[model samples]
Target: MGRKAKHVLLTGGLVSGLGKGSVLAGIGRSLQDRGIVVNVIKIDPYLNEDAGGMSPAEHGEVFVLEGGEEVDQDFGVYERELELILSGKNNITTGKMWKRIREKERRGDYGGRTVQYFPDFVNEIEEWLSSVSQTTMTRKGIQPADVCLIELGGGLSSYEIDIYLEAFGRLRSKYGKENFLHIHLDVLVDVLGQFKTLPIQDSINRLKRKQLTPDLLLYRHKNEINSGAKVKLSETCMVENLFDIPFLENKEQLCGFLSKSGVVECISEQLKLELKSEKGLVAEWKRLHRLAPEPGKVVRIGIVAKYNINHDAYLSLTKAICDCARSLRYSVEITIIDAEQLEEGLEAAIAKLLIADGILVAGGFGVRGVNGKIMACKHAREKRIPYLGICLGMQVVVIEAARNLLGLYDATSTEFDPETANKIILKTENSKENQGGGSMCLGAKKSEILLEDSLAKKIYKNSFVIERHRHRYEMNVEYAEALKEKGVVVTMVDEKTRMPSFVEVRGHPFMVGTQSHPEFTSSIFTPSPIYCEFLKAALENKKCKTSMGLNTTNE
Candidate 1:
């Protein structure tokens, strides 16, 4: 309820990866637990609307919010811990700003005044950030939030991130130091069994160059922080309120440390705002909980994807699955299988699929794991196991059907093979060639659900619903007839774009593939329509196990 927002900007020192996002989310979660309405802003240094076009192997998977924001994965942690849904305004990146500035120019909003970098570009970015902060608070039915967490993406000394640095400098003056809390995530390396403190010093030097010093120096390491190591880190970093927190590599202690260290309380006191806990909200949410199935039966979901190798990539999905499982009162176990690890002849893989209560090929990019996912889909279709494919997973299902069921051996996504003979999944016509940063379906776009008494319809038990999307390629309409002929039902089409959006298998207990990333739209209390149905199918499988007298185990 202050004129100036309580701002916390997290910036990394030295190299890029230092778990700034984790720290920010941890603090937000701790404060929200105290009943504070937290709004997070993720400002990526890269020039992109979102991180959608980036490779999952290089940058990790783009974590989408319930409102369909293709944002940095840290937002996933924030939403999961705080148990709140963030709108599209929660994320910002260089590409998003440039596009906005260009649009303003095109609309003649500048009134014939030519825009320049300093006051023009920087000012626009600042305005955008403030607007997002205000708008999100207004939408949440709370007074302007007691605190706003902002993450400056990449690192402090990033040459490419100069605009963000300058913008923050101006913002610091606007809010004054009293309302601002700066935290730096510093990484220390171990060279020849001795922990070298050079990285921490060099990191602090760069932050000093921006005329900003951290209120807290977070030494990121794996295990416990030793006294010698702490002294060495403090000597190098030399911050007033230095604290040692574990890296996100081990995320268990993240929330606890933030709460115990008084980081949330410190910020609230500095910002002169009352700290509110979300415990009441969480308890209220718990009160409305619908129990899952009895412990007699269990459902096992095989989530096949490239990012499965790292649990962080699927954070939001894991939360949603847990929520869905709780809703049905069914004991659910999710096994993450690396799609790229599939072997030839697939008999062993098929055996794994048969044991699963349902098969889910999750969203990812590249050809590295394509054939393996396609193989899983083929096995699911053959064995009649409940199957659910999302985003890139849906493309895999469509590609599999195009090749085996429809006899198109060359079916492929243009992202994998631009010159493939059967480009069953083509890039949007408006997409530019060779743009990696943001040239993709970046925001929340709706698709219509047309039910036909199919599995998808039975799961939703309704028609005409909207879900969020973040994908560049979609199934080619030319292959729609062929797929339908093979009993692969094209249940839903893009209402506005008239594109092929969703497909379901005929007579299958539950088999639905959507071009959109359904994981982005799922929440702790409210599951997306797609995931709700997937859980329903998973529950059915668990009931079958219960009928077989198999006791459920919650592992």
Candidate 2:
């Protein structure tokens, strides 16, 4: 009962790890460049309610939205690619769909009839897309989306995503063929020197079998897709629109590539939209690549992390650092120092830590590298090095400062050592242990700083600031004064819960920790105030070390 927005269905198959999210986001960026309002919807087929409870090793990073929704990492890609703040409502999972159906059943809205997956599921999905069209990104408000890009995860042939495909079929029928564009995204494999078309053919056949054919075939290759291969694919792949998405080291080139390759032109023609190219979106990427690397002027920041297997676990955090630092015209040199390295030898860890002017301890769960992270906090505090700790990082700051400054040797978080005498970080009272990791203090909360001259107040430029949180343990208010007496103060506290969220050391150049993750909302255009201030302090720290004739390089 609303105006129909153009719907584009993006499917994945024929091997994983293709930059489908980036490409889809790139295409969205291209459309937006032409003054089109584009909104992206990511449909995950997993049974989990959200990515919050998923393992970082198995599922990559759980990107937290501004509204505190833990979504797939692709959403992070979409935000950066489109430079728009999206809402959690845009992410749809099978678990979410099933829950909606059950709720409808409970309310007897289905007239007590049996709910089947065909028309019933399709109807629910239709309603979901319709509701999302009127939803805006960033906050809960109305700003009708002109185009909706639905990216489906779980390979094309999987049974988990068959319902979505079925739903798209009905959607195409209801909205007419012109309103929908189904895209099959995959990589064109090169075996030896031969370019194979069989995999691409087989994948499209699966889509046509479900009566849901893809109008566009956006594929990936290493510049191996020759003219003959393109013609061959066009002839056999059923649908005629074939676009080659070559691999690029810098993902920002996605839109620029799409524009050069005529993919953006074709999408606009097919959708019948009259538009003009602002040339603003692609220009930003060009500016970034145009900057030459500053040799000795680079700001080195050592990141003490526990997850070593997959770097995607810290994907957004790294992006925040690089984006904010670039705004200051300083090239970033991020060294992911494994916390386990510190546990084995403090002397070696200190050697590694001294090479960088600033040290950052990222948030993580488990007791594997707890002591190493605690030692890292102590090192940064005493050495006058700029430091920033997030979630678990903030907890370690308190634990380390309590042990060293307050003389509480047994101080530790309740999450790591529940039997410790000094439970500096107490388990949140609202957290439910029996319910399997659902009750977390998630989303954005208002933080109010008491001191007018505090660094946090200066960085935020406001006494009240809103930040996102994703933790279940918080700094205990019972020992707040005792910690303040030792030159550590809780500068920022949640306005709603009155829980201490931001902490700062008295005499350090820059030593601050927050229970919230500031990187989630950090953008190059409008960088996070905390990250901007932290990087500035790190640059100043480097200047001081250089004046002292200290060798900051690892070599």
Which candidate wins on lDDT? 2
Cα deviation at 482, candidate 2, in Å, is: 1.9
Estimated TM-score per prediction? Answer: 0.78, 0.95
lDDT of 2 by residue, 1-555 (tens): 776678888888755567778888878877877787788899998889889988886788888877778899998888876776777789999999999999998999999999889778889989988878654464344567778888888787677877887788778777866788788888778988878888888988878877777888887888656798888888898787888788987766766787677876777778776678675877776576456655556788999988878878899899999888777777888988878889877676667777877889999888888888887888888788899998898888899988998899998888888999998889887898855446888887889998987888888989898888889899999888999998889999999889999999988889999999888877666678888888889888888878787756422
Lowest lDDT block of 10, candidate 1: 281-290
Tens digit of per-residue lDDT, candidate 1, span 1-555: 546456788888757877777688777767767866667888887876776666665677677665545677777766655555676578787787889889999999999997888888879877877776752343245456656788887865668877776667776777777877787777767666667788778877776766677777777776555688778777767787777676643343566667777676667776666765446543434443435468554678888777754566776677677667766666678887767677454555555555677788888767777888998888778766678898887888888888998788988999899899999999976567887535666556656666667665665666665666777788888888878888887888777787877898886777789887666656555666677778777767656655776424211
* Position 271, candidate 2: lDDT: 77
Instruction: Judge candidate 2 at residue 113 and give its lDDT.
Output: 90
| Candidate 1: residue 115 Cα off by (Å) | 8.9
Q: What local distance difference test score does each model get?
A: 0.72, 0.82
TM-score, structure 2 vs. true? 0.95
